[model samples]
Target: MRTVAGTGVAAVVFAGTLVTGSCQASEATGFGRLHPEADFLGSSVPVSERAGAVGRRTASVSAVAPDGLPGLDVSHYQKTVDWPGVAARGAKFAYMKATESTTYLDPTFATNYAGSANAGLVRGAYHFGLPDQASGAAQAEFFVANGGGWVNDGKTLPPVLDIEYNPYSTADWAGWCYNRTPAEVTAWLTDFVTTVDDRTGRWPVIYTTRGWWNHCTGGDVTVPAHSPLWISPVASDAGGPPGMPAGWSAYTFYQWAKSGTFPGDQDVFAGTAADLAAFAAGPAS
Candidate 1:
C-alpha cells in the first residue's frame, strides 16, 4: 500500500503536512509491522461488557452512511470500480480513500471520485489519518486540496477522517505505533476535525474502531456532537449495535466486514436513503 516511498528528507508544510511527502528521517525505510484496526482496537473489552463474539474480540462500533443503507469505502485495493456497475448492484453511497499520511495519495482517488459521482451515488472522500506522520490540520488540508473537500451538495457525503493503526507499524517496517498520551492524540484529532470543518463548512465524519480510540484518547475524548461517528468492527458474528464513542449515542456508519464485497469495503448505514440525502445536504444548504 505504501507506494512513492523513500528514506530521509525534509519537505514543505502547508497546513502542517509535507507537500512533497519527502522522506522522513524518523521513519526508517526498512521498518516494522503495522497492525490493522482489529489488532489495535476492541481487544480490551470484557465479554459481559462487549458485543458479538466475546472472548477478546473487537469492541462495539459506531458509524455513518445512514443506518441500514448499504454502502462501502474503496481504496486502490479495490481497483477501478464500475461506478455504474456498483450503483446498479445496489450500493446507495460510497466513501473513497483519498489520501494517507502527508505523502501517500491513493492512485484511484480521481477515477473513483468521478465514477461515484457519475453513478448518482452519494459519495465523499476520506483521509487515512497518520497521526505520527504530520499534523492533523496539515493532513486534512492536503486531503481537501486533493479533492476530499465537502460541500452542501446533496449528492455528496461529508468528508471522513479514517483514524486507526497503520499497517506498517510492525517492528519490521516503520515500526510505527502511536505512543502519544490520550490527551495528545485527542488534541490532534480535535485539531483535525476543526481544520476540516474550517475548510468544508461542516465537521467531517470520524472513522475508527473503539479499541484504537480508547488506546489513543484514553477512551474518553469528547468528539463534537456535530461530528458523526463511523465505527469499524470486523466480526463475522457481529450482531449488536457497535460500541458508541465517548460522547455519541449512535453511530452514523458502520463497517463490519473487511472482505466479502466486490470493488470496495462493505459497510452499513443506520438510516434510509432519504436520511442519507438529508445528512449530506447539510444544514440550510
Candidate 2:
C-alpha cells in the first residue's frame, strides 16, 4: 500500500489504498477537495453564467439529434449506483472515474467498472488529471496501474483523460488553468495522451469543455489525431451540438447534462449502437 503524507490529519485508508489524508478529510467536510468525477465544469462556473458568452450556442436539443445513444458517467459521489436501473432507463454506455493524479484511486472504481459491465453496458474508465501536481506520464502510469487500462473487447471503450478546470482552485490560489502557462499546459497534456496511447495501444479519449480548452491551451496544442473527443457542453446552453476544440472535427461522446434520465452526468454516443460497439472493439485488427 502506498502512503502519502496527510497534511494535519491522520491518514485514512479506503479500499486498501492510503491517499493523502487531507483529501478524505476535505471531502468529508465538503470543502477544499475535488470529488472523483464530480461536475467540475458546472460547479466552477454555472452554465447559466456562460449563456451570453461568445461562441455559446442557444439552439434547442431537438436540433442536435434524433438523440444519439444515451450514456452516463459516475464516480464515488453516486455511491451504490443502480446500474441495472440505469440500463433499463436506456443508458447504453458508461464511464467511471478510476484514478486521479499519481495517487488517489476512486474507492468505487472496481465496483462501478464491474457492475456496469455486468449490467451489459459498454463501460470504460477515466482519469481526472492534476497536471500541476505531477508529470502527465506519471499520472497516466498511475491511472493504468490502478483501473484505467483499456481492452478492445467490444465491452470496453478507450480510457479517457478527463482534463478540465482545476476543482481545487480557490480565492488565494491561481484560478482556472491550474497555474500553468498555456504552453506548459499543452505540453503536459501531450505527454499524458502520448503515454496512455503508448501503454494501451489505443488512443485515450480526451474530455474537456470548449472554453477551458481554449483558455488553458491558448487554442493551440495538437492532440493525438486518433484520440476521440468527449466534449462536455451544458445541454441547455448548447445551441445545437457543442463546438469542437481545435484538432477535432466531431465529438465521439457528448456529456450534455450533469443529471437527467440516468445517474451522474448524462451523455450520448455520436453514432449508432453498432458504431459504439465498433469503437469499443478498437481499430480492426
| Candidate No. with top TM-score | 2
Q: For every model in order, what is the number of clashing pairs?
A: 35, 3
lDDT of 1 at 179: 60
| Tens-digit lDDT string for candidate 1 (1-285) | 122333222233433333232223223422122222222122222233233222343333323233498888887666668889888888888887776665555656677888898999899888777677678887888777776787777887888888765444442112222566778788888889888888888788888766556655777546746689887664432566666657677788877655444455667778988899999988631
- In candidate 2, the residue pairs with backbone N, CA or C atoms under 3 Å apart (3 or more residues apart, or in different chains) clash, namely 57-239, 58-239, 59-239
If scored against the real structure, what TM-score would every candidate get?
Answer: 0.75, 0.81
lDDT of each: 0.65, 0.72
RMSD of 2: 6.0
Superposing every Cα of model 1 onto the true structure, what RMSD results? 7.1
User: Cα RMSDs of all predictions?
Assistant: 7.1, 6.0
lDDT of 2 at 221: 46
